[model samples]
Target: DWVNLEAHELNIPKDESTKNEAHWNCTLKNRTVKVLRRWLNERATYDKYQDRDELWLTKKATPYSSKSCNYLLTRLIEEGDVPIPEHKEITWYSIRHGVATHWANHVGPHHAKEQLRHKSVTTTMKYLHSDSEMRSTAVEQIW
Candidate 1:
């Protein structure tokens, strides 16, 4: 998978009943192997990260709670002067949604579902709205 579970220290379920069902294998291209290696190396250089077992460590050397990554990204957006078109606020989820939407348009929705790890294509289908231009072209073809 693009995001290798092997690289991240996962919290394995202790309940034996659930353990077998907890994990799914996905594949990423070999192209990311070097990028993954670089991220791991970068993570190692942080202060106070020595005792941390989590995959993503905060700059303060603490383990990332759910909000911390978002907080960091928000800070980066402000610091980097990233222009938000239409004054739209951005979130990680928005990025993920955008990727899934575009991917579904480029590839079929099934591939997008795999990328997003959606159990059902219905979940991915939400992102697959047809563009007006595409709709217009379809109408022309029918005429």
Candidate 2:
């Protein structure tokens, strides 16, 4: 299992209601590992800056404002060569919602809450939608 140890090592405060730092472990496929290693190697080729602040100021690395990130994503969708299905309304936040929902469906509520770093379980639950099929299945399990 490939663990993203970075999140676990983050010295953030945790409360009963919220987890500030979240991590996920996955079985790393060879191709994905190779790709990640390549990216890290490429990044290492550049001279190290004194600190994160200096790097941000001196290099092309700038903080991504939420609005700017969303705008850039939309532009990429519109102009990029990749074929994507037409959607009437789509926003960058939807991707986060989708990931939360998917995790909730596969791993159950408790795990999903931890993974998402949600302040409240209620907020995590909001991502999970109840459909008629799921309701029926849940009812059957109770009997």
Candidate 3:
């Protein structure tokens, strides 16, 4: 699940000054919007502020610090008692990397670039690199 909902739940207006509109719009999802609405509704019960601006205090609302977010995630992972994957250690970032890599390999570059909001095709290409062993197998089959 996306982590930024706490800020929205606290009724914090996004800091538009630093917002990368392109990046945001590109990655925005219907699920994220729905979660944000749920958070706002939950918070509204206890919160007295009526206006959107007041509810979402630009400076005072809890900031979504990535480091803290990761720390909390680590704790949750430990608490879940889930088995670790046999092949690799799964981290929060692996999900993003997997999505990017999957898109680049399966969907092609231009579509992947748009989905990822990557500034450069070269950056997107990095994700397209399949494992060397897999590449070798692919080449053998094709040739």
Instruction: TM-score winner between 2 and 3, please give it.
Output: 2
Instruction: Give one digit per residue, the lDDT tens place, for model 2 in 1-143.
Output: 13233332222333322335444333344665666667555655665533332212223466555676677778887788556666644567777677777777777877777666776879988887655776799899997
For model 2, where is the 10-residue window of minimal lDDT? 49-58
User: What TM-score goes with each of the models?
Assistant: 0.65, 0.55, 0.53
lDDT of each: 0.68, 0.59, 0.59
Give the per-residue lDDT of model 1 (tens digit) for 22-124.
4544444455566666877897887666666565666666777647867877889999998878877787667778888778877878989876667789988
lDDT of 3: 0.59
Measured by C-alpha RMSD in angstroms, how accurate is candidate 1?
5.0
- Candidate 3, residue 96: CA error in Å? 2.4
Model 3: per-residue lDDT, tens digit, 1-143? 22355343222223432323432333435677687678668767644434343323323355446555566666787899767677766666666677877777676777787666666778877766476776888899999
**Which candidate number maximizes TM-score?**
1
Best by lDDT: 1
Candidate RMSDs in order:
5.0, 6.4, 7.3
- Evaluated at residue 139, the lDDT of candidate 3 is 96
Candidate 3 Cα misplacement greater than 4 A, ranges: 1-24, 27-33, 46-61, 85-91, 128-143
